[model samples]
Target chain A: MTKPDVLITGSYPEWDMQPMQEAFTVHELAADASATSLPRDVADKITALAMKGHAPIDGAYMDALPNLKMIANFGVGYDAIDVEAADARGIAVTNTPDVLSDDVADLAVAMLIAQARDMMGAEAWVRSGNWGTQGAYPLKQKVSGSRIGIIGLGRIGHEIASRLAAFKCEIGYSSRSRKETPGWQYFDDHVALADWADHVVIALAGGPGTAGLVSKQVIEAIGPRGILVNISRGSTVDEPALLDALESGRLGGAGLDVFENEPKIDPRFLKLKNAVLQPHQASATAETRQDMGALQRENLLSFYAKKPLQTPVNKTGKSYPR
Target chain B: MTKPDVLITGSYPEWDMQPMQEAFTVHELAADASATSLPRDVADKITALAMKGHAPIDGAYMDALPNLKMIANFGVGYDAIDVEAADARGIAVTNTPDVLSDDVADLAVAMLIAQARDMMGAEAWVRSGNWGTQGAYPLKQKVSGSRIGIIGLGRIGHEIASRLAAFKCEIGYSSRSRKETPGWQYFDDHVALADWADHVVIALAGGPGTAGLVSKQVIEAIGPRGILVNISRGSTVDEPALLDALESGRLGGAGLDVFENEPKIDPRFLKLKNAVLQPHQASATAETRQDMGALQRENLLSFYAKKPLQTPVNKTGKSYPR
Candidate 1:
């Protein structure tokens, strides 16, 4: 039997690509590749799209692949993919979630402690012979028993709160609705949570509706002694407001894993010693990434076999006409 | 009555010093200052010593302060002060403990996750615009749900284990005796624990008895895939063997907060990319340090009042001649 043709719409690890090449007729596109980048014949043949990164997949892009029945997103956050558009055209959308939650939560906690304790500064003190020349590294604030306000109580947010509880942090969260957590305080307003938090971690989903969820008012509420950690999408936060707060010491510090225009993040972030910047790598662990790839492939295989999708985000009422 | 004369044997934070100066006749000495550093008249008048850092306080050194009755150490570890010599001379010795355990544990967990995740490398990628110029930071190993071995299960070690447990790590420990922990595996031997652990943390107290406890064999047992985190004294591990392993990739990585000759640590440690070096700052936080200072002072104040010392490490049967 002829293998089904699939178009990879972003840069992926070689581990994911190698096995995928063996099971399917694979076509590649750059992470920023447009519909025009593909030949007319190849675009017509692609029955599925394996997507990664933050490149937007709109209705127009989906229309190019006429037979495309499914989009298997590599990571948990599928905000970049317009689920409404995919549903309108009967394209089943499946995201690799739960698998990457542990890794993301681990990073959220790591960044919180790293920034709180100034791990990089302390490392530099030892490496630069400053411990010998200068005295001890300047004392920083303690992380244990501090008030932690989680901006969203989703899977990733819950995981972060669970880990921090062992550190004796008082956990509070602001979500659309209350979650069944063990005595974690819930807030209806983002600004209220930020005001109460010694540290605030952003774990909300991204998209137009949630854009600027952490607004200027929220940033101001997370006062000078407060640390903001964002492991979620850059769209969840107001980057300019965050930058201004960090620069002026209006916000204590930030441990950001994502930013607007990431990779090419605002140069202002580079100057602030208070921010712990990272290349959107919360789920960027070899073990977890491999698992993610396997899950992504599983969804693709299910799509071709006419079996039910494993973890679909949107179930279209109508079947694909393929 | 005239204020009791007390000599501060090491440089301390102003928060600690300010209070000490107000209550007592404060005499200053550098961290590395010796008996000869203090004027003979001042040494003769000194009744108490407030100590910090790892400066040796031997029997001969103690004899110089003819009126010295007690020594109050700033940190949890009292190995630097000769307790045996103090006992012989009937000089009361006290150290601040329990108060700094949370901060030390926080750093231990921070360093463990930092090294495992290569947090410094990731931050550098963002800061140097490598994330934009190159691509994603290289994938690291997953820290959550890994097998962790705690070498000592004392107050600080227990705290570290407790925090890591929330990260979903399988906790194993090697202590002289088994602790009543909730289902944490216990190994009687250090080598066995190292062999079993994905990561091993050394939290044993530093002294002659426990010196070089994490031997060359233990380092070898931890193997190439294992990471070592030492928040305990540097004297516990074989530094030469550790360096060799780190350089050769026989050991995966290390997160060191203490070293044999810190400040002037072996130049080789500075060269290893796999090792996360810190300037012995496990308990160096503003809130914790303030508490430590208060505890140390409480012991000193009790000593001058002819009351029982608050946190004495050595019980000198005889009262000081002073």
Candidate 2:
């Protein structure tokens, strides 16, 4: 009973930590630390592991925690987790999704408009005392009423499309199959969708099947007047192709929340005046992150109560429904 | 026939300049030039003056252009022109309003989201290579579903409300008079509206009557969690009260387009991380500006054609409808 019951591998907000600490005997491990470095007593008693968005947790990590029953993920996308491995070991995996959709979608729209309107440059013009000395920032393209192509019509994509729709934008999308949605035009191929759209947004699931879905060909089809927005995983877009296109002025601009090998993202992107860079903070809003932490805790509480997991991504040893 | 038919007193997009040159014998004057500075021959021949959003055209300026029959403004706000002065001289006035409403409203929404999500800091965290080292950015408030209070219920405000509606935000407004709208909560006092709202957006017209409408009391009522978004005019807000609140952490943050002494904005704002500054580019979108130019041209052309004006904001002598 004295051993810590949970391991919070990734960090959460300080406001969320107090409640989490009160509810469970929690042990925290630094995000950069390997699981093998965990103290034996702490690892032996750990029943659940809490994770944020970007961390690779495979079977080897699972083996490090012999008694681990569930992985409570703080974000919607669980692509970084080896769910198949979790399932094979009868370990339940749960993720926080719907709670963060509005925040993520709001951010996607914000980034798109910020890029198209030259918000960053406009701000700089004012902050650098240039507006008085030089002149108004140059005019930028309007985001409203443009034909938008959405890649992957999943929950977050749908939310982004819905918000943009209110701006009177025409919606088009490329998903694996034609969805029941009637207003949005669907394309079987990403390239065709890009060609048809004035703007393209990457919202596909991030996994082996969807990696590099927005290829060089697809980006080229988007053309110069086109803006691209990505609120999904960096793996879903061709980072090198995207960088080249943006630098060469083949693509109009980008509003990116993710990047391949992010944090250590290509330094070339730093010099780009056309891109609006965000550190994968689509669901980083305090309101949404708090909700996500609560949901993660909820899942853990449900598992301990012997109830079907709240948002189970995979089935686990007789605890979740098959 | 020897008279200059149209005098362009302000700069316009090059795309608009070509058409004006073709349609009429044009006399161009620098925006900085006082009307009296124009050569007497040139000033005497001017039949109509084309104006942009800024650059004052007072009675003295109007008095200089004796043959000026009309003033066709390139922006929705004709506040820069002394309408009383124009009317006394029987000068017809028209403005480009609805054409740029979507673009302005789109910008207001974008600024709000960017401020709430800390897009600027997040970008720096990644570009400066801190995301890998510092872990993640601190969480921020969510924009979607927050109670948003608009200071005006005019066209741009209505447009902003419609777009935010899709994000599921609860909309409230304070206007001169309550409108026929049903769902939005109405508070006649700006202070009352701020007290109830999580965020307040300024959409009120800027003028002598509307100056300092967002007073110290109202801004304080919005409190620490409330964000202020201003797209309307710098005069509408109490800039010093706002600056003090933001610096003291009494008010949460701000997304400002217009400033009290813009260009020469308060240097304190540049140091605050809680601000998103723009150089009044709400309608500075290429599509919208082009459309505005076309509309301004249309008004000037209509005056020349003796047709009922397109968007007459005020009337003049025998040529305009009484």
Candidate 3:
């Protein structure tokens, strides 16, 4: 078999590349590699593009590599890759989905409980000699048996809801319409769900139409006693509004794994005692990432073999698979 | 009818005191109020002693209050009370149990996930501007689906096991004997259970026999990469051994709610990044505490009415009801 040359962009675990190396002549490129720096000879032969969410994979970049047949995203979200542009060029788009859901869901619940119990502050209380000096860490809220509302009842959201259900939490969700899944109460409007919930978790897919979908109104609707947890994109929330609400005690607290600018999160968030901040690492468990990397490799191999793609995001007409 | 003078020898929730004041002529005293400080004539009138765990209710102290009829403990684990002395004196000992189990279990699970996810470090990474500067936070171990071993499958341990079961965690337990609860693996030997589990949680009762139960041997058996969570009494585990193991990487991490000398804990545990230290606050949630306070009040009210105590720890020879 003539190994299809794959142009790998963005940073991944060094260990995860062993199988990629075995199956293809992989070209390691800086995520922001300029057109001139792109190896001209390798570009002509590159059939598959492997990249992370932070890496740029736009139409112009795809056009540069005319032989590109598919773009295999390392993580579930394909927001980094312009799906419409890839579709226009007849390039198949694939994301490692169900493989990473459990880790993401676990993280969502972990962060939620961390906030509910004030684990960060509680730890600080012990570390700073406060427990010994002052007294017990002040009482926080209980997480189990509370009402939880999940926005976007997708794979990751369902995983979160399922796990929370085990905690004896009342599960509700918001989507375009009611999902086929029974036992969960569905709200048409996101704001309505927030109003009815003790905690609102943002789990919707990130992209153009979804930007600021959990607006300031939804934040207020959830009220001061309610916590907002985001394991999804920061763009889905009105970041400034959230900051204002959190700072002013208009909202109770937050357990955020994602941020608006990311990495360069707001400086105000650093000082807030009520917030439990995390880097966008919901699925960054060693085990899950290893599995996701394997799945990404499988998607590439399946595309090359002309078989059905394991997890397709878009219908690139001729090469599309369920 | 003249009210029975009650000496509340310990701090309690301010909100809870309102009802206590209404029900009886409450004489508030410091948790460590000496035998002499108790008003002279009131001692004879005092029918019941409402105290917390820190307030000593030994035979010598109980002798000071000759007319004392019962000891109503504010929390579970009446280790401070000389149960044998109380039984010998024919004075009932009542503890607030079962009501606080859910909160304690919730905290155990919360701290477990916090340790598994490195939530403390993850939050710091975001807060200190390291997420943008240093890239993604490093991958951590997964909590869900991991093997969990619980010591003392009592009310709180049972709650912890039930919550973990929702996360698909494989459950094992160690106690004097196997419990009625099926589906959970049982180990009579504590060290054997620790050796088999990825995580070990302490939920045993605190006392002399149970002291150092989770000893150095059991900690070594858990080995590295295994997280230890203690929601039980600090006396239940050997603290010095735990500190040594955590410091030397003999154990991967810990989520501790108790210490050998609480509120005066050993300072060595402050700097360990892998640890998620809490202030012995397993049942410290506001909602749970409120419920616990209400239950304590009920026990006192029931005692005064010549009715059976609500949550009795030992028989009093007189009024004893469910």
Candidate 4:
């Protein structure tokens, strides 16, 4: 049997790419490819889109590939891919979840501790010969037993909360509904959670519903003694307010993995000593990325075999032609 | 009822100093003060010593202070102070313990994840505009579920192990005797522990018995895929071997907070990209430092009132004059 045509819309590691090439007739697009970037001849042959990165896959992009049956996203978040649009057109969207949750949670906890303990600055003190000439590094805050607020009690958030619980932290969370987690305080209001926590972590899913979920008031509530960590999406926060809070000392500090217009993030963030900035590599680990690739490939293979989609996100009934 | 004469042999925070000044006839000495450095007249009146930092308190120094009755150390590790000489001279030695365990353990775990994730390098990538110009940061190792070996399952090591359990890491430890810890595997030998673990953390007390405990053979056993973290004392590991391993990639990487001849640490360490260096700051947090200071002061206050030392290290019975 001939390999099915697969359109790859983002950069993937060679480990994923090499196997993908062997299994399918793969067509490549730049990670930053727009709807117009796809060649008309190639788009017609593409039946499946293997997606990665945060490049938008909207209705127009979907319309470009007429025979498109499925879109398998590399990471858990599919906000960049307009899922509602796909569902309306009776197309299926599948994301590689669970596999990347551990890596993301690890980075979230890492950033929280890194910001609290000033790991970056402490390392700088060691490297600059300041530790010898200037004596001990300036004392920073402690992490263990601090009151921590998790903004979303989803898969990743639950992992983060569980890990921090071992640190003897008081875990408080704000979710759509109260979870069954024992010993965790549930807050319906984000501002209240921020007000009570020494450190606040955002693990909310990104999309229109959560855009600006962490507002100016939330930032203010996480006051000067409170640290804010975002490992979710840049769109989940009001960047202008966050930058203002960080700059004015209204917020203690931030350990940010995602940012608004990231890569081209607000230049102001670069200037703040209180911000620990990461370039959206939260789930970017060798072990986890490989797993994510495997899962994405598995979903694509499942669709091809007419087996139930491995991890379906939307109900696109009878959309895939048998 | 005059206040007893007390000599302070190191730099202490103002919070500790102000109280010491108010309670006793406080005498100041440089943190690097030696036996010969002490003025004969000032030493003659000193009945107790309040210590901080890693300054040596030898028998010769004790001989200089003829009336010295007690030495209150401001940190958990009293390796710098000659405890044997203090024992022979019947000087009550007290060290601040338990107070700084959380902070030290927090840093130990922080360094482990930081090294694994290349957090320092990641931040630099963001700051250098490489995140914008160069694309996603390179994938790094995963921390969660990794095998970890704790060199000493004492107060601080137990804290580290407990915290790591939340990350779902497999915990193994090497201590003088098997502890009451249920899920943790115990190894009697250091090399075996290193061989078994993806990360080896040295949490042993910094004294003669434990000096060079993480030897060259152990470093080699950790091998090219394992990380070594030292939050204990500089003397606990053979620094030359550690340096050689890191330089040669005989070991995967290291997260070191202490080093031989630190401050003046080996220049080779600064050149390596694989290692994460901290300036002996495992217990250097504002909250913990304040607690340590308070505990040290409490011990000193107990000695002045003819009470038992709060955290005595040696048996110097009936030596302190009532």
TM-score of each: 0.97, 0.96, 0.97, 0.97
User: What TM-score describes the B chain of model 4?
Assistant: 0.97
True contacts kept of 4: 0.83
Q: What order do candidates take by DockQ, descending?
A: 1, 4, 2, 3
Alpha carbon lDDT of residue A164, candidate 2?
96
DockQ of predicted model 4 = 0.83
Each candidate's interface RMSD, rounded to one decimal? 0.9, 1.1, 1.2, 0.9
RMSD of each: 2.0, 2.1, 1.8, 1.7
lDDT of 2 by residue, A1-322 (tens): 4533888876666777888888788888876576789989778988888876476889999999999988888888889889889998888999987999999899999999989988887887888889888877888899999999999999999999999999999999999899977579999999999999999999888878899889999999999888999999899988899999999999999999988887777888889989999988888777787888899988888877778787988757335744
lDDT of 3 at B99: 80
Model 3 chain A TM-score equals: 0.96
Against the reference, the lDDT scores of all candidates come to 0.90, 0.87, 0.86, 0.89
Candidate 4 deviant stretches above 4 angstroms: A317-322, B317-322
Q: What are the per-residue Cα lDDT tens digits for candidate 4 across A1-322?
A: 8999999977887999999999999998887777567778888888899998887899999998998889999999988988889988778899988998888988888888888888888888888888878888888999889999999999999999998998889999999999999789999999999999989999999999999999999999999988999999999999999999999999999999999888888888889899888889888889999999999998899888888787888877234434
Selected candidate, larger TM-score, 1 vs 2:
1
Between prediction 3 and prediction 4, which has the larger DockQ?
A: 4
Estimate, for each residue in A165-237, the C-alpha lDDT of model 1 and write its tens digit: 9999999999999999999999999999998989999999888878999998999898998899999999999
Clashing pairs in 4: none
In the predicted model 1, the residue pairs found to clash are: none
* Tens-place lDDT digits, model 2, residues B16-126: 989988888888888767889889988888899888647788999999998988999888988788888888888999999999999999989998898888887787787
Q: Model 4 over residues B28-62: C-alpha lDDT tens digits? A: 88878675677788888998888887878899989
Return the top candidate by lDDT: 1
